[model samples]
Target: MSTTQIASPRVALVTGGSGGIGRAVAERLGAEGMAVAVHYAGNRNRAQETADAITAAGGRSVPVTADVSDEGAVTAMFDRVQETFGGIDVVVNTAGIMLLAPLAELDLDDFDRMHRTNVRGTFTVSQQAARRVRPGGAIINFSSTVVKLTLPTYAAYAATKGAVDAMTMILAKEMRGRDVTVNAIAPGPTATPLFLEGKPQQAVESLKNMAPLERLGEPVDIAEAVAFLAGPARWVNGQVLYINGGVA
Candidate 1:
């Protein structure tokens, strides 16, 4: 959709905006003329670069930092955005961590750490979005296609995303009268550092062929899906969009 489609300036908070998919989402929203908050956890410089890119494109943006799992910090992040852009109209919770391990080999500490940022972080951010996002706004949470793919070494990561899926469905119901749409985007085998970090070359090549598209998903591919939900897809609430190029 064109930037002109947005009648008024909408504000968006994109968590993990320093990272691959999150950066794409932030930039896409900015291009749509939304005042964007490029959120980061530790990579302040990268987040600033994202914000700078948006501003250079003649869009309004700022870099904000917060630990998504911390309610107080998340709340503060929201306040900072509101103070800067007036009010939040969209929230894309893309701040997540992925640790791959076979179920039997996964350490409890790894499981807990992964869940802390993935599950708890999404919940905390969604909770704030539920209360703070304006009417006609949206809450876009991130899930993974692994939930359905049932990948062997993705047990813990998939479990966290499963929790996200459940929360998104129910949150939509809870927002019935609020006019705020809630949904999740599940992307399959995206080409991001998080996905490629420890994977062997052969394994990566195998995953690329899983989809009929014959390629790993791109960050922009996921961002395009987010743009739809954040802007024009008002009737598409409570759905889990699987944007995996026919990979079921």
Candidate 2:
């Protein structure tokens, strides 16, 4: 039999699947027997590596590319996935950018750049997912616990996530009776390249100690939450789940 014929009926499109946390979520969904569409903004090679890993582990996947902030590009990516896998059962939006500066010192241009990717990207993908995902599916978005922490340099970044949290709840209600759950995962101080890029050892240690578990969150930790919401968490709609190890 052909691989596509034998593949699982479920399909998942994971945006930013080349990144740390996103890659983990994609692989976990793949392991759950869902055919995955790994979406990358630019790094097709890394995305393909993720897909290859999934395929090696007995799952089917393809690497897709698009700028998540562009509605047309995102829609095209979704269309391609549907054409390949029949339909989408889950949509996970994990593409985002973080630029830290105190509100007083932050450049408006930096804020706009972050918002364009984080807020606009989530909105664009969620819009497509709402229109396309099959019932009994899910739309998982990325948020940050920093919204509650209210850290000084994170004002602009947190604002973007605040929008995400608000949108998540409203989208859940908007999808009423559609059997599709909309939720956001708010992870705190995850040890991804994006989070660790320029931070010194001391800063990283401080964040690790803040969590009661006394360690930085791993990509797998957040991925486990994605797997839950993507699958059997039918009743867990319209909530921003904080996977920060008791940090917030």
Candidate 3:
């Protein structure tokens, strides 16, 4: 008699998996043959939809929830992923909030909320990922092209992403001997609910025309980049990939 052994699939925990970009990334990774933990802050149904889609595609997925800025909650999210999938190989931090206003007029409350979600949330998730992601794993964080474009009303949001850039670089070095990679993806003008929420159609068209590609990014475009970094781009570490279609 002949015997064969099966290898376990890699597992991914995608924060904000209920949202547009996050959902695309979760599904993309799931299609790549990894079990996925789809995380949402509030909308459990949407997260479960993402998971269900993955499962329907003949992949493994589960919906998990947490407030990314809360350390205890984030810890439990990781625990849940591990309990469901056995181990984590990749973590994609797409959970963030954007509040745009001129630097002088930006409300302090808005700043605090943005900072908590974009910066503290990434920090909390990165901390846990730093401790737990297995060897040869990857940690992907979200940044924004506003940091480079220096858009006037985006000062507060850009500041948060700048912090993420700093943390990503340092974390890559800190994981020096661990064989894990840390990187950030800075996407420009993606047409997600978050980006399109408050903008007028004319303003949206202007943004679309700004890019050399003459179009706003799709969530799948960002997901494609995330898939590359999370899977094959092992040497592409400690870097911020600007996926802006030359808008900068």
Candidate 4:
């Protein structure tokens, strides 16, 4: 990892920094002068690519692989972070899985997968952050606007994000005197591979135009918001900021 004379660079661990929103979040954190730990569950190649870009541009990053659902793995991931970067000052939980199906038709496998990552994984990472992150550090969690929309076929996914929103508020209070902040970002229809997979071109365009902004969100759009939450958003805690382009 690289260092500067002005201040010791802060280390950030971004879970799911392999692709899509996670990639942009890691890059944005790097640009903000934070040494990042780009954590991925299985996609080391993509994680390394993100880390390499940061290091190449004079910032520093390390790619750590761990399944957040596994308590042992999450612990190991944090251990590695401390070993490599001295300590973690921020943790962003971006690793989530979405399973969309009506309540009745929902497969138990899909339900378990989504809950395991979106809910349990969030808790696992947040616990580590609570225990490991230094005072004045930040924890940023991802929620989704679908929770607000209460959309069909997103029952289980919405429930998980609901859990996230609740956790953010509670965790913020738990860190009351510690100078730490916890917040959840609920984004609308972002143009990530996970969301844009296999849609017809016309249907994609229609969905794009559904938002008041008239286009699907770019990764930079969400990244900019995340950067603020991780840096300048000190007073904003225990709140769910919706970056949905005015979509309900």
Q: Model 1 compared with the native: what TM-score?
A: 0.97
Lowest summed lDDT over 10 consecutive residues: which window, candidate 4? Answer: 1-10
Alpha-carbon runs more than 4 Å astray in model 4: 1-7
Tens-place lDDT per residue, model 3, 1-248, is 11211225999999999879999999999999999999999999999999999999999999998999999999999999998889999999999999999999999999999999999999999999999998878999999999999977999999999999999999999998788899999999998999999999999999999998999999999999999998888889999999989998
2 versus 3: better lDDT goes to: 3
lDDT of 2 by residue, 6-118 (tens): 22479999999987999999999999999999999888999999999999999999999999999899989999999999999899999999999889999999999999999
**Model 3 clashing residue pairs (backbone):** none
Clash pairs, candidate 1, are none
Q: Look at candidate 2 and tell me the lDDT of residue 128.
A: 96
Off by over 4 Å in 2: 1-8
**Per-model C-alpha lDDT, please?**
0.94, 0.93, 0.94, 0.89
Put down candidate 1 lDDT per residue, 10-61, tens digits, no spaces. Answer: 9999999987999999999999999999999998999999999999999999
Candidate 3 similarity to native, TM-score = 0.97
Answer with 1 or 4, whichever has the higher lDDT: 1
- TM-score of model number 4: 0.95
